[model samples]
Target: MDYNFLKSLHIIFVVSWFAGLFYLPRLLVYHVEAQEKDAQAREILSKQFEKMEKLLFNAIMIPAMFLTWITGLSMIYLTWWDSFGSHTWLHLKLCFVVGITIYHFVCRHLIRKFRASEFILTGGQLRLFNEIATILLVAVVFLVIAKNTFDMLMGMGGFIIFAIVIMAAVTIVKKIRSNA
Candidate 1:
């Protein structure tokens, strides 16, 4: 395969992986909220959501994650492995990737919990947890694209501030909903 073609495939898989990451948690939020409904409705929603989670995890997320890794490693071996080893930005990106990988499996565990009718996390808390992947995605993309041109200290500070802002927004929205 051509280099560009392989790279494009990798990008496609990465996007798919992210799509799973984003949507699966949202489904969990819905599943959790379903508890508020009557028993029959809650049972239907939980079963549907459980099936959706399994299909999304197996059909999309896992395959995409592996393909992304395969293409990524292939690209590194074919072209930039040595340069990657020397780059601070790549190192940061790898750390984020590892973090995302952990998040991926944690979500898988969450799917199992949902399937088993184990409602450990509340809907609001799951909503907060769902934002974690987005945060990591932002960090990885910024690290790669910005490279050394971006300020590390400033970026860290900004990320902390961003998390705070997100949390505050969620809380404010919750309060508004409750009052209304």
Candidate 2:
């Protein structure tokens, strides 16, 4: 019932949620890449990834996201949303959370698509997609920690640049691996 307890739990679930957000996409990359193998090998690995993906979604990602919302909303309610509801920083952070929640469901859709061997996204595209979450995470974390003092415009610009760098690095790595 205490605010501090809810905050702590919220933090814990936030961490868990981000962990799943980070990893599930990576699993997708692996799953899609596995399709390049011979049919038998691809079947075996796809099945394995299917199990891992399901377990991660059901056991970790979904639950953690739910709890993160529960604990976070509890804190807001318990405090009467006094200082939070009107804050621009909180608004921006919540918008990012909303974006990622949509992203989470999109990932679920991707899982089903992949399960049925309907690969709309290539492995490299999926890698770039994963960076979207990373960029959102950076923005949300900075917003929460900086609050009113945060510079949203500057931070968002920086995140865009950071995401571009990450994608470029991934591209370089992929090229190197392919050329090797």
Candidate 3:
């Protein structure tokens, strides 16, 4: 396959994936904010989220995530296998990618629960989640730009993992609290 073609697809998918990530959380904000007492409003919110999830998950995120990894690995193989081990940027990117994957699954589960309308996180909780995501994304961008040594890359990766763990723990606690 043509390297350029894969590169193009990778970029497109990545942009789409990020779009979905940015917008999905915002949608969740609105969805959770809608009063359950207002049937029409609640319905509208639910419908909007469901629609977003379908497009974001099926059309954008899923495909992008796959293509991003595929193209990334392919590019690595085609161009950077020898350099990969020594490249700090690539190492950092891979670690963040793992973080992204974990967060992706967590988001998927959260969205599913939201679709089910089982519970709503408080605005504060949602905000916290948003902040965590934003910071991790910033770190990813930084690593992409900086591309330092493995030790530095691992430090950033560690921070990302910590952020993810905290987010996941908060979400689980919220779920338990809501159920209670």
Candidate 4:
């Protein structure tokens, strides 16, 4: 298989997977917020959100994640098998990918909890939680684009700053929504 072809497939699936990762949390937030509705509305919204979450996670996210892994590993095996150790950026990117993989399963767990009517986190917290994928996406994209020239210390500092900004923005949005 051509490396470029595999790279393209990897990119496609990565985008698909990230779309799920990004949207699933928003669904969870909606699910949490739906609890504040009237009893009948809450029941209807909860069931609908659960079904949507299940369909999104199972039909889209899980498959995309698997294909992303397969295509990614295939590319690595084809191009970097011999010189893999020297690619610090690849290592960092893989670390972030692992983080994303963990995040994906954690989402599944959250769905299950929601199915059981276990709303553990507030809507605001879940809104903040959704930014985890954003952070990982930024880190992974930076590592890939920067590749061999990537600086670890600078990246970490940038991630911390970005995270603080995201948290502050979420807080402000929560405040604005409450006031509205």
* lDDT scores of the candidates, listed in order: 0.89, 0.89, 0.73, 0.94
Candidate 2 residue-wise lDDT at 76: 67
Off by over 4 Å in 4: none
Query: Which digits, one per residue and each the tens of the lDDT, describe model 4 over residues 32-129?
Result: 98999999999999999999999999999999999999999999899999999998888888999999999999999999999999999989899989
lDDT per residue for candidate 3 within 45-77, as digits (tens), equals 788777877677777778878888888788888
- The candidate scoring highest on TM-score is 4
Q: Give residue 106's error in model 2 in angstroms.
A: 0.9
Strongest candidate by lDDT? 4
Please write out the lDDT profile of model 2 over residues 74-174, one tens digit for every residue: 87677747776578877777888999999999999999999999998998889888888888888888887887787778888887888889889889987
In TM-score terms, candidate 3 sits at: 0.73
What lDDT does model 2 reach?
0.89
How many angstroms is residue 105 displaced in model 1 relative to the true structure, after the best TM-score fit?
0.6
For model 3 the local lDDT of residue 75 reads 81
Ranking by TM-score: 4, 1, 2, 3
